[model samples]
Target: MEWIIGIGVCAVLVVIFTIVTYNKLVSLKNRFQNAFAQIDVQLTRRYDLIPNLVETAKAYMTHERETLEAVIAARNQASSGLRKAAADPGNPEAMKALAVAEQGLGGMLGRFMALSESYPQLQASENMKQLSEELSSTENRVAFARQAYNDAVMTYNVKREQFPANIVASQFRFTAAALLEIEDQAKRQVPKVSFS
Candidate 1:
């Protein structure tokens, strides 16, 4: 009779442990997802600002059609990549695609800015100045959001990989999360937007 009671108690404890681990994994997953959402908001804001900047420059850069078009194309690709990553923020392939697309966009924007410097009228335009300020602000916000997301992902991943928690994670099919890192060395630099 005592052995029966001991068995029952052990079983209950095992169940409780499993439940706790599962709940923790879920909570961490949710936290990282929320972090990704913050990044999404900032990137969305950045994407929205691109077209306005392009339009403002279009007036002053009549001969720079190819560069303008390239910028728009890169923006569209980056937008698509953002949608994919937002759907599953830490999926390896999706995050990789987002990073590449972002790199392309950054390159195009840099070229556009360098060209814009040639047009004195475009540099002095009030609309261009305002857009540059907003883009710079959005870039800072994105950097913060990305750091928060990476931190959350690292925490969640470490928790998921821990001994007893790893057992529960595998049982529950909790996948590993990927970090959002820039792939290219040159692309690591954010475009310098100066309207001064």
Candidate 2:
């Protein structure tokens, strides 16, 4: 009789433990999903802002038509990549595609900004100024969102990989997610400064 009671208690404890671990994994996954959604919102805002910025600069940047078109094309590609990544944030290939697309868009935007510097009329325009300010603000928001997403991902990954949780994770097929990375060496490099 005592042996039967002991066996039942052990079985109940094991079931409880499994349930707790599974719930924890689910919670962490949800947090990661929420963080990615924030990134998506910021990226969507950026995509919408690009057209206005391009239009504002177009009047004064008539000679730079190719640059303008390149920016638009890059923006479209990034938008598509973002959609794919958001659909499956855990897919490394999709994340890499989005990262590359974003890098290309950044490069194109950098070139457009550099070219605008040579056009005094574009720089002085009120519409351009407003659009530039908005874009800068949106970029900052995107950076913050990315940082938050990365942090959440790191935490979730750590939890998923820890000893007992790892057992549950493997049994449940809780795959790891990819981080948003910058693939551009130029973007990673620090700008050279000269005081002289």
Estimate every model's Cα lDDT from 0 to 1. 0.94, 0.91
lDDT of 2 at 52: 95
Superposed by TM-score, candidate 1 places the C-alpha of residue 104 at a distance from the truth, in angstroms, of 0.8
| Candidate 2 ranges beyond 4 A from true positions | 183-187, 193-196
Task: Please provide TM-scores, in order, for all candidate models, with all chains considered together.
Answer: 0.92, 0.94
* Tens digits of lDDT, candidate 1, 165-194: 999999999999998886555656788999
- lDDT per residue for candidate 2 within 1-196, as digits (tens), equals 9999999999999889889999998988888788889989999999999999999999999999999999999999999999999999757898889999999999999999999999999999999999899989999998998888888888889988999889989999999988888566776799999999
